[model samples]
Target: MSSSRILLASRCATEDEISELVFKLQALLPERRRQHLRRVSRDEVLEEVCSYIRKLHKQVDDTSERISQLLASADLDADVLRSLLQQ
Candidate 1:
């Protein structure tokens, strides 16, 4: 039996984890939907691109916070915000 899928963001994935994300994206889209996306109008393309970027940003932010919590749990010294704010 085919499993039903729920659409949701994987917030734990880091910015560097996009390779894995592309594989999931390809899996999520059906063939006809993929084909339509490929041949979509300029407005639709831009909107979809913007949506993807926003989702990526959300994923990256979530990953950052999770990493911070892990570091604190391990009693390690690290400040991701400090580094980002530094440069």
Candidate 2:
């Protein structure tokens, strides 16, 4: 094959791989989030993923804080608390 044709083929393969990955990412998102968007672009997929990640992080932080407060109020022994946390 000529050099130009080889380059074109390689580029097409790369684009296809990227498109497949984006589709997979979109699939991983929640149904409600995906329902509103039709014919989304790559940038929109990335934005949704970022938003989902941020929401998850916030939930983790909130849960951790609540657990700490409950442990403190209970006045549990240090060893017991540590073991509970490990579990």
Candidate 3:
């Protein structure tokens, strides 16, 4: 095969792979998001993913802050705190 045909074939394969991965990512999203994504572009799907990640990070930070506050207020001994943390 000519170089141009080989390049075209490689490009098509790459595109197909990207499409499959995007579909998998969409499937991982919440049902509401997936429904919205049905007619949206790839860029929109990516934006949704970014938004979801930010929300998760916020949740983690909030939870960590709450845990620190609780630990500080309790003022338990080092051994007790270490055992509690292990659990």
Backbone N/Cα/C clashes per model: 0, 0, 0
Candidate 2: stretches off by over 4 Å: 1-13, 77-87
Q: Which of the predicted structures, 1 or 3, would earn the higher TM-score when compared with the native?
A: 3
Write one digit per residue (lDDT tens) for candidate 1, span 1-87: 223222222445544465455544644555664566765454565555567678889999999898778666764344864675468
Query: Tens-digit lDDT track for model 3 on 1-87?
Result: 889978998767666787787788888889998998997777888889889889989999999999999998997999999998899
Worst 10 residues of 1 by lDDT: 1-10
Per-model lDDT: 0.59, 0.86, 0.86
Residue pairs with clashing backbones, model 3:
none
Ranking by lDDT: 3, 2, 1
Judged by lDDT relative to the true structure, which candidate is superior, 1 or 2? Answer: 2
Per-residue lDDT of 1-87 in model 2, one digit per residue for the tens? 889978998767666787898888888889998875559898999899889989999999999999988976897898998898899
The clash tally of candidate 2 reads 0
Question: Which sequence of candidate numbers ranks them by TM-score, best first?
Answer: 3, 2, 1
